[model samples]
Target: MSLSEEPIAPTPTTQQDAPSGFEETESVNTSMQEFHQLYQKLLVITLVLTGIIFISVWIFYSLNTALNYLIGACTGVVYLKMLAKDVEQLGAEKNRLSKNRFALFVGLIVLATQWHDLHVLPIFLGFLTYKATLLVYTVQTAFISDS
Candidate 1:
C-alpha cells in the first residue's frame, strides 16, 4: 500500500518516550512548582515577622496602632499573593499589572497617612515587611547551602 493509503497501527508509549515539547512543558511545571513552594516559604516568614512586630507594637503603643499594623501587614501579604497569581495567569500583561498594583499601593498609603487616627509609621513598616522578607529569603537562597 502507498504510505498515504496505508492503515496506521497504534503504538504504546511510555513516559520516557514523551515528545520534546511535552518534556519542556514538564520542566516548566516543575519550575513553577518550585517557585510556588518558595513563595509559600516567604509568605510564612513575612507573617511570622508581622506577628512579632504586632506583638511589640501592642506592648509599646496603643491598641489602635497595633491593629493598624496588623491590618497593613495582612493587606501587604494579600497584595503580594494576588500579584503572584496575576503574574502567573497574565504572563505578558504582568508589567502593566505591576504598575497598576504600585499605584494602588501608593494610593492606599496616602489614604492611610491622611487618616489621622491611623499611625502612618507602623502601617508603612508593615507594608514594607513583605518585600523585606522576600529579599532576606532570596539572599539566603543565593548565599547559603543546604549542607
Candidate 2:
C-alpha cells in the first residue's frame, strides 16, 4: 500500500502547549487552596497569641476584677478586629465574615476552657452576642445588596 493509505496517529503536544495541570479549573482550585492554607496559618497564630495574652493577664491580675475583665474582654474584641482586618488585607474580603465567625466560635470555646472558673460568663456571653450580631448584619447586607 502507498504511504498515504496508512492510518496516521496524533502527534504529542509540543513545548509551546501549556502544561497538563495549567487548565482553568486547576488554576482556580490552586488559588482556593492557597487561600485556605493562608487562613489556617492566620487562625493558628491568632489563637496562640490570644491564649498567651489571656493567660498572662490572668496570672498578673485578678480575673474577677472589673478592670481586668474589661481589659481582657476588650483585648479579645480587638484581637478579633485585627484578625478580620488582616484577613481582608490578605485579599480574603470575600471570606472575611466566615473566617471571623469561625474564629469567634473557636475563641469562645477556648475561653470556656480557660476561664471556666473565673466568672467570665459575662465576657463569653458578650462576645457571642457581638459575633451573632455581626453575622446577622452580614447576612442582611448580602441580601440587600443582592436585591
lDDT of 2 by residue, 69-129 (tens): 4544554556566665565555434533344545654675576568645445545543433
lDDT of 1 by residue, 1-147 (tens): 788999886563875776788888888899889878977898899998898989999999888889888878887897788777776766545454545567757876888878888777778777888988888788888888763
Clashing pairs in model 1?
none
Mark the regions of model 2 whose C-alpha exceeds 4 Å error after superposition. Answer: 1-22, 65-147
Kindly report which residue stretches of model 1 are placed more than 4 angstroms away from their true locations once superposed.
1-17, 90-97
Query: RMSD in Å for candidate 2, one decimal?
Result: 11.3
**TM-score on alpha carbons, each prediction:** 0.77, 0.39
Best by TM-score: 1
Model 2 lDDT vs. the true structure?
0.55
Q: What's the C-alpha lDDT at position 10 in model 1?
A: 57
